[model samples]
Target: MSSSVPPSIPRQPAAGSKKQSAETATGVTKRVAPGGKHALTETEKRGYALGVELGSDVARQQMEVDPKFLMQGMADGFSGATLLMTVEDINGILAEIQ
Candidate 1:
């Protein structure tokens, strides 16, 4: 069995690009250690819901709107959470059911 993945998962940029997409002090490494491995410690764990479809450009376009960003804001703050996990899990379960 195999797992499908996102078309592209953006790579965590090079060390020089530390501040890029990082929610932290401006250009400062948030880690206490020299390597700066992790930015922040998890304060909580949370659950999520997701919907995915491979058809229809219109549907995809609508999903890109920012109105939903607020609804999804810090709700995705949990340690191990992502929008695609739910999609893949549901697909795997359905495949097994069939």
Candidate 2:
């Protein structure tokens, strides 16, 4: 006699969706790659968070902001300064911006 159980179908990712969400069910943010290609490298995630924090600080200054220019400036600054900086140093910079 044959068994009556059916096979399970595999699930597939949606079309054109290359990366999965970086957050967890507990509402913690998982760091995805800077460009979302794969798992986040430390530099990539730090750089992104630095940019976001600094950009928000700038926005609160009420100046006209160009996002591309702002991001490029932050990238350049981080490239040179990150190696020599601490989180406190970065926070000081953000605090002094206003």
Candidate 3:
């Protein structure tokens, strides 16, 4: 499937935005800074939590995953940005691991 990147990622809010809302998993809402910089939305928060949990699992399994690449892949996937690697590349990596 094809997808396009969003104007801004969760970590970086769009410029000139008045306010950004941050809703936690517990449903608590808070306003970000005046410029709404470095604020994450509810979806972003959940995605981050899930990412952390999965990362922990990978660590527990003693998997040697590069944090930089893993984060980049997650960002690309979430923002619909062009993937750094092709499907075949990913398959080949997985095959090697297997």
Candidate 4:
């Protein structure tokens, strides 16, 4: 299935590639607001910043968090796209983590 999420926020990196730092990975800071078109509004920028903070905290705690999968899940949730995993699968994973 196709995603509405922009390519800048990739779902995954190419195999064998080193993971980038959060700033470079997200490309949020480097993004230019182009004539207000495709530009994130103040609220959207704030939300993304907050999400990054929260995700960072989660990563610190979990240590094994895959950012690509996290981004894909968030994008799916926000875009109302069909999730990659079922509710039961999610619950099972959460149960395992717990």
TM-score for every candidate vs. truth?
0.17, 0.35, 0.49, 0.52
Quote the RMSD, in angstroms, for model 1. 15.3
> Residue 17 deviation, candidate 1, in Å?
9.4
**Model 2 / residue 60 / CA error / Å:** 2.3
Q: How close is candidate 1 to the true structure, as a TM-score?
A: 0.17
Angstrom error at residue 39, model 2: 2.4
**Model 4, span 16-79: residue lDDT tens:** 5454333534333333232433578899988976876766567556668766677788888788
True-vs-predicted CA distance for residue 43, candidate 4, Å: 1.1
Task: Write down the worst ten-residue block by lDDT for model 4.
Answer: 26-35
* Lowest lDDT block of 10, candidate 1: 45-54
Name the regions of candidate 3 deviating beyond 4 angstroms. Answer: 1-45
Worst 10 residues of 3 by lDDT: 1-10
Greater TM-score among 2 and 3 belongs to 3
| TM-score, ranked from best to worst | 4, 3, 2, 1
Residue 25 accuracy (lDDT) in model 1: 24
* Model 3 per-residue lDDT tens digits across residues 1-98: 33432343345545775666776444545455574345789999888678656665666667998776776777787678877789899899979876
Q: Which candidate gets the maximum lDDT versus the true structure?
A: 3
Which residue pairs in candidate 1 have backbone atoms (N, alpha carbon, C) closer than 3 angstroms, thus clashing?
none
